[model samples]
Target: MIKLPTISTYYGGKGSSGTYQKIINHVRPHDTLIIPFLGNCALTRRIQWPAQVIANDLDPYIIDQWRNAELGPRLDLYNLPALDFLATVLKRPNLGRVVIYCDPPYPLGSRKSQQLRYHFEMTDRDHEELLTAIRFLRVDCLVSTYPNERYAQQLSHWNRTEFQSQTRHGAATEWLFYNYPIPEVLHDTRFAGNNYREREYIKRKAARWVAKWALLPPHEQQHIMEQLIIVTPNVIVNQINN
Candidate 1:
């Protein structure tokens, strides 16, 4: 978990630092993650990254900030329109197990204020196009948005989960829509529970297991790990299918 320097903030950044755990609870493994709507990259920065990560934003200032961070050679940063970036990426070959996580500008129709605050604000039409593009993508996709009628109608078939979050204006319900079912194997197990209490309970339970395992003899530990390796895949497959 090498942490990169934090990027500067933007107006209406949709910084998910507060709610990222909730959103990440629904994530699963992928070879690469594409963030076409990278703002401050709050959620992206916090996640357990995959083999590769590509983030894009139309705003040059935001991309420049990321570039200045020297985010290392592994991260591919782009300053391109979201849809165009997606289209270009899709054309590339051998993209195995890609996941696109979009935190696009909140639709004006769903917001309290009619005034646009972002460097690039999205209209209802813009949201429609984005949602449509996501719908047709062959690989997995996850989107964060408010509970808007147009969004609901467009992504009606997609699976959705929500979390209560605090915004500058006050409390709000943030929805995460995914094309896949909730995975049996998570991308990161650090945020594994439904709520704060449950998460703490899981943390304690894992700690207890770790302590108990540490007390076991070397032979016993090896035997247990071997058995688990032999059994886990089938169990996971069964759980996912059901």
Candidate 2:
């Protein structure tokens, strides 16, 4: 029988105690850390490392929150463009092993509408660019994402591993993609939500808007109004219709 570390024991309230411990166990003290889209740094603050740490995200609000932390001085927090951030990191003198922990946005099409704001709907080309940029780092990186077929296919090129675990509220199966092989252990799992009306409402509205937009002609687009207004004379014309 194969046994893995039980995470339930260190599931601290609100913050991360067990997950950080697991991360620390995986990474040595000297490894440089990079956490992308760190929301409040709930899991990151617990990482006990003697090396340098960099927390990056496209959201200025998130970066501001992280920067305001009492322990913010220890970690390097950057509020820059994602590609620019990668470029800056690449140019650093000491390009050692970097452990990147990314929790990118999972667009579920909610009323809040964070998709456009965060540009969460990443394509294969975007992931390929990211993979190429960070592949040279001399360390293992862990990325957490919701289970999706497109994402799985995109990451299939890497050595992939899956870990099935239940969150505090629900059961989730997470995949871990690594450059190297890791141990796989079997864990006995248990079973499992109803807001059907709300979901249907969103779906219907989205479909309606999509259909409306699809029917719109090229010249009838919103941008066309600006050009039309510019070309039209401001003077009033005599109305003559036959």
Candidate 3:
């Protein structure tokens, strides 16, 4: 049997699909969305971004994968440093109502260093550059990071969000900072259940029930299988009629 690489097999960062939709709610296809620091390009593959979506990163390999990801004509992936490319894109005129999402390398000083790993590791200066750049930007932006005393102290004026996420490492809490108020649509997570996580949950739930049934004693298992033969056909017929 051949083992397939799951979503986690992609190194470094992968954004939650639900989070991606919240980011999507703010815009339509006519707007320009810039993802300055594309880690796993999760933001790219997960949603059909309405407007033009431009994404860039420091790594060429990631750029290759991003371009080849079959997202469609609206997405333009590039290999470039995050700050410089972002600055260039922001400067472009007539682009109008730009939405820049900065999901960058976690700084060494941040508490997130324990759970997060990145090949393009960010230093203290890099963190400062990123935060300062976003603060002054005229464009609307969403920045993802984790909680830290220094960040709270430095960015006290900006709005912060504690997003719920889980990992095998444990139930993890990540953060998001925005220069402007996040839209009410993003805050409402009720519809977010339509993603892969819910489907995976249902699949695992069914598997557990089947596994428990297998563990029954031989006679019981035989009796149950016999019963299933009679019950399964009727159930299938009812489902087909429905």
Candidate 4:
């Protein structure tokens, strides 16, 4: 497994926990992940490495912290308002296979009826605007938020799945709204399987295959790999066409 640098602690930061893997399962290694409302960038750090990650936040302090963290070349940090940053990204040419993951602050209504303050809070209108902005984008998008009638109405056409997330206060239900159909095969096989046990089983099976391959002579190994490279594309195309 690829090791990624850990993001520093920030107020209102979504730490490296909860249902982030569920969201990452939908991403491919080739996808350019855009985080418009980057807080701690919990999701960006945990996703498959060597993937392009563009993250922006309104707070310059957080952006500077990330700059000092040495997060490597794969991640580009931007200090701009979420929507403005997204607008800049949209103007760029040839941004291949983009996936925008929106984790804006929880709406006021969803904040357990208490006035919880953050450095930047997304008002009801701001949340609506964010959702509206991504609605027309050609790239795939996934939004993480609490369940509410406003989102239900706005994202009625979008696919949704819910999972329990631990909040500072208690457990809360978090929802993911996505625009694309779930691929039968995830781009990153590391995130496959329905549960941890199944995942471990697959991992062991993969290790066994690697062990077997290692025993092959160098020339035979090269031949097998070349054959796989030739056939893999056609198999992927057939899957897509089916």
Predicted structure 2, TM vs. truth = 0.53
Reference-based TM-score of each model: 0.89, 0.53, 0.66, 0.81
Candidate 4 stretches greater than 4 Å from native: 1-18, 213-242
Count of clashes, each model: 0, 0, 2, 0
**Candidate number of the best lDDT:** 1
lDDT of 1: 0.80
Rank by TM-score, highest first. 1, 4, 3, 2
Q: Sort every candidate by lDDT, greatest first.
A: 1, 4, 3, 2
Local accuracy of candidate 2 as per-residue lDDT tens digits, 1-242: 21211223222111432333333333322346777656544446554543667778776766665565545344787876556776786567774656666555542421133334343344556655665665545556665554666556656655554544345545545554555444221010000001335545766777898798788897677666566556653411111100
**Better TM-score candidate (1, 3):** 1
Please tell me which model should have the higher lDDT, number 2 or number 3: 3
For model 1, residues 1-242, the per-residue Cα lDDT tens digits are 56564654464544544587877777777778889988876668777787778889998988887788876766888889899999988777766778899988888877767787887888777887888888866788989888888888888898999887767778788888999988777777788888778898999999999999999999999999778767896655543442
Q: Write the per-residue lDDT of candidate 3 for residues 1-242, one digit (tens) a residue.
A: 31211245554354554555544444322367788887675555554454577889887767776666566677777777788898677767767657777877755565443654665767778877777777767767777766666567666787786755544444556677766764533321323433568746756777899899878899998887678768787544433332
Minimal lDDT window, size 10, model 3? 184-193
Model 4 scores a C-alpha lDDT of 0.74
lDDT measured at residue 143 in model 1 versus the true structure, 0 to 100: 91
- lDDT of the candidates, in the order given: 0.80, 0.50, 0.63, 0.74
Q: Candidate 1 regions off by >4 Å?
A: 1-9, 13-18, 226-231, 235-242
